[model samples]
Target chain A: MATLKQVAAHAEVSVQTVSNALNAPHRLRADTLERVNRSIELLNYRPNRNARSLRTSAVELIGYCVPNWPHQTHLVMDQFLHALCAAAERTGRHILLFTAPPGVDGMPTYDDLHARRMVDGFVLSQTETHDPRHGWLKDEGIPFVSFGRVWKESTQPGPWVDVDGATGSAIAVRHLYDTGRRRIAFLGWPKSSGLAEDRVAGWRTACKELGLPTNGMAVRCREDSIEEGALATARLLDSGRDLDGIVALSDVLALGALRELTARGIVPGRDVGVVGYDDSPLAEVVSPGLTSLRQPMDRIAEELITILTGDQQPAERLLLPELVIRGSSAPG
Target chain B: MATLKQVAAHAEVSVQTVSNALNAPHRLRADTLERVNRSIELLNYRPNRNARSLRTSAVELIGYCVPNWPHQTHLVMDQFLHALCAAAERTGRHILLFTAPPGVDGMPTYDDLHARRMVDGFVLSQTETHDPRHGWLKDEGIPFVSFGRVWKESTQPGPWVDVDGATGSAIAVRHLYDTGRRRIAFLGWPKSSGLAEDRVAGWRTACKELGLPTNGMAVRCREDSIEEGALATARLLDSGRDLDGIVALSDVLALGALRELTARGIVPGRDVGVVGYDDSPLAEVVSPGLTSLRQPMDRIAEELITILTGDQQPAERLLLPELVIRGSSAPG
Candidate 1:
């Protein structure tokens, strides 16, 4: 409920100055803009949403559709969403997270938003291998972009953007090799998620190039959950695989793998080096401070909104993931 | 693409019978209903969402207002959101992750739907201490149920529903006290969050009731993160307070606290009794699995939606949480 006037008081500026920084950004000096912004955040100022929205028949609402179809999707990219949200505001758009179980048998369904024109367009998550949603959106000509491309997508046209999973996974395996871990093991996704599958493929390719023995070096899970990942790791070890380095396909699985290793009295960075993907905050907090492939969620989000808003074109943008060497994969 | 004919084929029933069983439930026998339901799940059948929603103007969109209004949030609970999304599908509502940033600054903002009338209502998350969102929604008569209720709003007429945080925290602390740990430390969230503050209050009240000393019992958050929690735990131990039990406000924090305890060569649940909030999947994956509080998101969602669409007066609702005892806080 903090107002522009309050923000102005904190920034030692006039109401108009505060107003310009918010509405007419180009009108203010750069330093003044910075000060005004700092004051607003400091005050927890929310310009009356309803009233501001009333001014524009188009309320800066950006709709996100993360289909909770077939298997449930948790949508853990807060780092991505949070960053994209900040970028969307820069474009004067607000985000509305939209997901629904497709009723009937359970296909992905959108509530009245799609049918009633509730959104200007959508930023969808987890583009299916053969996405019906993509075709439907194309047929309807609704403005939208996928967080990833569908299997059939040629050149990933039509406002879609993504973090290249194939490249990221390869980078993870390559890092393990670089860190003096020759016998690398991949604990990967078992199911049919395009991204997960891509990571697995990347790992296989990395192993093939490195000339590492692929036999019994791979662990799979029906899902990328911590339980599935942990259980899979345990199962793989119990199955008696000789592995020196482990590169998990996801942060969750990495955490799970970390636990499994811990239970067996294995030191992560020493006994069996570990590396995770997604670089979720959990990766940073685990005991060994997990080494991970950092997905530039902010960069992807930046490009996603840019493409969706027509400021940029639909391009298969690959943001290079940097390997954060933490204690889990810290050189012993 | 899967139709009633396909469902009938899978279930070995005629299309007419399948239709009768699904739409005309009263016309079907009890055995038929059970078979159809079982077949529906077995086939992973999701009735084409558009077809089912084609009749209702409801657009079927469920808005999730992900609180990104210039504040820190916990991470583990996000995994639960995936589960909740799955649960919502069972009930036929899609979840839209919504975030209203704080205006141009980083306060709070909502969707254009707030004005354009695009969405049915909202599932507001991170209820503040004195949330004006509740008041505004009430004034506008917009349907919304909070994921967690605003602090100081127990008596207000509400369409809000949430897990009983106080009760959950009390359960964890009482368990600790029963196990003969009197000097307990609470780690977690900032004082701003009504929910976190409530957890701290619950810990304090429980400690006083058990006639334990208040010296070592304190709620502190250097930062609202697991790394923060770990660092805080380290600092707390270093500060030379006689601490026997620790109740972390979140699973991520508890994980961090566990790491901190172990780094000091202290065994969690043995040398120190540790309890965590949010029995996230990681709670089970960690070695010496974390004993944590479970929030009933499904219950929260069900009650909220029932109030939103159901013919019920606006009233507050609270769902009791479960204390899942695991290895992290195994009773001695």
Candidate 2:
């Protein structure tokens, strides 16, 4: 709270001298600069960056709307958020968080924040088909970037960075096949979800290409929960598909499969291989550590930041995920 | 990005009339106001609250310093942040997040944000004994509220809201006792942690009141991890302590204890009761769902907002956590 004049008086220097000591230290004698700095420390004076930002019209705050994903474990969003924060911090920016009101998908909050000029731009996540926010942001001419790609082609083009869920599923299938499990099944979400459909496509392509049986080897669930996953797994097992491997679209589903397998007294790694997506921390702690696909969250975050800040044309990036093999998918 | 003039031109009204339509609708005829509003919507004109705040000196932003706690599961922090965001939303404010540089406390960021007037006040978390940020904020005369109480008596009194960890642990003890467990043991953290110490005090108090033997019934770990927890549990079991019940300070630690018990063919809930804190989503997902203490994060968040925005004197509150019963501590 100390003023420049107070600091100058404390250091026995003119106000111009103190200002020079702070702004252009090379213009002042080394001793004078040191004295002014000492006075600043003594009085705990801090430079006002916000005032400078106001002049430059750069708040250095990125808006992020927290989505209410109806899932039991929010591990994916939590980790992605942390990575995004670290990415933003590296660029001397901070995240301004707000939630959409009930039954709305982030439009009102985004419009208010952008209109107020409280944020330089925004970083969007959980993009879906026909997302109204995309068209709205484009119409408003607000600078923004998304962590998930816009699924519909009719929407205006925008910068986005996303993980390739299809490739992730293929990689899991290949890992299971290489481990000598030819009968591979998939536990996936309903077809309405584009991302989950993409994952299922990868499973079918891989199964046919590898000369494996593909009929009745997949189960689709309506919700992404362990209970639903377990029920799906039960239907798969009861159908007598002779499946020896299962690749879940999410870690939660894989955990449910593991629970079902344990209850049935089936050794996971030895009798049937299991793999999960999104190598959540639970994957490592669970019994017979789950094999999972690890999304490049940090890289995706960095790319989103770059797209938001860069002065180039609109961009799109699809990054690959790494397959982390654990005991659940290990060859016995 | 539409200007007020553009909206006024489209509505065929003067700039003052447009402003009046937005600010004082009664001043204009209903038809005139409706015409102006339609023009505003068509042009997507939004009022500049940031510029207005310069005059009002109310930014409607509360600064929060994100701590880099080295833990695998961040469920507690994640849930608390969501609750805070929800609470802030109710009050028409938002949370601005910043991280402290490595090896330093939050003082530098707090000072910068406060000095710049980018934030009206701050919400502090993860407080420790002799935290320098507390003293610095007080010295700078900044309004702030803490989610954890300052431990040192010499530190200046400030508004804070915290969970009574001792009471949480006592509740866990009472639950275990009511389930017909007598020799209840505690899995805790190192003595240096004040919160963990409070939990230990509660366990001791409740055990002594119940006339249960307390000697050799506590296992202390250095970190809040499943590995450390399992090791502590192993030590307790190896020491012949006859502990039929275990109370862990965190869900991760209790999970490790569960793994240890399961490996030894000791069924949890049936033989050895187990309880964990911070009723994370994992508590319900894990097989034989974990019994844990659920902190009232929403209430705490509401209390924090009240303290930061209240017109009353600085007040401190310690809320009691609720015990959520589950299969992990069910009576067999």
Model 1 preserves the real interface contacts to a fraction of 0.20
Question: How many pairs of residues collide in each model?
Answer: 30, 0
Candidate 1 is graded, for docking, as incorrect
Task: Give the per-residue lDDT of model 2 (tens digit) for B149-188.
Answer: 7665554467789999999999999999999999999999
- Residue B222, model 2, lDDT: 76
TM-score each candidate.
0.61, 0.74
Per-model chain B TM-scores are: 0.71, 0.80
iRMS of each prediction = 8.4, 4.3
Expressed as tens digits, the lDDT of each residue in A1-332 for candidate 2 is: 99777998999998767766765465578888899999999999875555545533434789887766535466766678777888888887888887775334467677666655567788888776767777677766788998887665554457788889888888888999999999999999888888888899998998899998889998997777766677888889888777689999998889788767766778888888999999987787676889999999889989998889888367989999999889998894
Please compute DockQ, using alpha carbons, for every candidate against the native two-chain complex.
0.10, 0.16
Q: What is the TM-score of chain A alone in each candidate?
A: 0.73, 0.80
Per-residue lDDT of model 1, residues A53-137, tens digit only: 3323434456664443433434355666777776776786667555554432222244234433345677777666666666666
Each candidate: what lDDT? 0.70, 0.81
On TM-score, the candidate that comes out on top is 2
Model 2 preserves the real interface contacts to a fraction of 0.30
Docking class of 2: incorrect
lDDT of 1 by residue, B1-332 (tens): 46667889887877766765655454567888789878888777765444333323323555665555333435544554555555555565555554565323222233244433345567666666776766666665567777777677656545777787777778888999888787888886777677887788888888788887666456577565667777888888888887788999888888888877876778888888888887766676566789999887667666767776666476678788888888777665
